[model samples]
Target: MTALSERFTTARQEGRTTGRTAAVRARVLAYVGLTKPRIIELLLVTTVPAMMLAARGWPSFSLLLATLVGGTLAAGAANVFNCYFDRDIDRLMQRTQKRPLVTGEVTPRAALVFGFVLTVSSIALLAATTTLLAAALAAAAIFYYAVLYTMVFKRHTRRSTEWGGVPGAAPVLIGWAAVTGSLDWPAVVVFAVVFCWQMPHFWALALRFKDDYARADVPMLPVVTTALSVGRQSVAWAWATVAVSLLLWPVATGYGIGLGYTIPAILLGGWFVVEAHRLLARIKRGGDMKPMQLFHVSISYLALLMVAIVVDAIV
Candidate 1:
């Protein structure tokens, strides 16, 4: 009986230890989830291309590494703050209902503090390893995304996506500044490409999740207007994005953005424009709009275009 009791006690202790270990792991993952890693990946898509273009090829290894890491942290900080502030709305949207804050996996206070730490660390890292302008741009982007877009524009206006694109495009400028220590026409053109590209890209997403936005009382374009109107706006922005992308070759004459980028840019932009028009046509036909089709295509379009930029800059 003494041996049996000791064995039972030991088993219970091991079980408790295992339970604690599992809980700790979950908490750690919850914090990571608050940072929105997928968005950080897209930020990299634009950032690396701009850095390459600005450097006219690969920048120094240390500068590239530092800029990418700092940019990732900055994007993470902005996302965490967005999650903290938008927890209420997120709880209402089914797609976001499983997010860390919404699911109570992370507390708002802890997420807020994490965001601050990330913001400071990212800025410090950038300033130490790259230009001050790069660090400054990162700070401004975080502020714009977290405070202006999340707290104000997103909640109140149908044009939120348009205005919000400013911070979204900041990665281009930030990457260029990291290499060149200043912004220039090339940076501005790439910035405009991303800025104009976001309208159609995000409007397509908004259309797919219109009910979610409406349920949350957010004023996303699709939530505030007809699908037809949103489709028209998307087509307009799609062409605008292509036009701005074309302007990059002229602005970056010495940067080797020649036939390689131009041909692919034209082809890719044509595909994006066609998809946007297809969405509009579907809406007009009173058929299934299938908005996510354009959303997915927009992802491909930007990624491929950025790849073209990379190839052109290197070759």
Candidate 2:
């Protein structure tokens, strides 16, 4: 009887422990989902290439992994923190109402704790694996997105989208820091490419979701101007993007990114400008497809352009 009772107690304890473990796992997945990992994965596509280029070839696989892990954690923390900051506004929109914070699956206090923990942990990890500069840049990115963009610019003016470029451009900076342990013209070129690329891409999304943004009283560029004006701005930026990317050839000391890369970059630029023009035309006619097309092309352009950069570095 004593042995049987002891066995029964052991089984009950195991069951209780299993139940708690399951609950903890569920909660952790929910938090990870809150980070929008898909978006961060795309951002990493930009991050790794920049790091590789800055290193002038392959970098330490171990350091690269650490940087990537730290970057994902930092980016995740930024997203989660942003969700918490915008919880009230998120509840007001269809696009965001299902967020863990908005849906009460994760309480605001819990989210704040989670985000802070991730942010601190990420910076610590980066510092441990790389230089303090990498950690600092990562922290700055978190600050720019979570505090500057999410808390301030997002609530203030229509130009908020433009100001939010800081964080968008940061991955390149982080990439450069991770590899070179410093910043330079090549890093600046990469940062400019990504920064300029975001204007049109995000503004198009803003255009499509104007009603949602307006409903939330979020001050995005599209909400303040006609679609045509935004398109014109996009085209102007696209032109600038093409120009900056072309300049990168000389900057990287012709790192194998010659006419082979140049031709496609120019072609892509022309297409972007044309799309921007089409967006302008559509707006004049009170339509919308062009902006959307330009948005999609912009994504392709960035991916291809980075591929060319990597190829150039390799050759």
* lDDT leader: 1
Worst 10 residues of 2 by lDDT: 253-262
Tens-place lDDT digits, model 2, residues 1-315: 999999999999999999999989988778987798977976887887788778877789999999999999999999988998999999988888888888778989999999999999999999999878999999999998999899999999888877888787788888889887888888898889888878888998888888899999998998888777887888788788888888877787734456666777788778877777777778788844555677787788888888877777776
Model 2 TM-score, 2 decimals:
0.90
Clashing pairs in 1: none
Candidate 1 error regions (>4 Å): 1-14
Model 1 lDDT tens row, 94-206: 98999999888998999999999999999999999999999999999999999999999999999999989999999999999999999989899999999999999899888
Error of 1 at 170 (Å): 0.6
Off by over 4 Å in 2: 1-26, 254-256, 288-290
Q: After superposition, how far is residue 248 of candidate 1 from its true place, in Å?
A: 1.3
Each candidate's TM vs. the true structure? 0.96, 0.90
lDDT of each: 0.95, 0.84
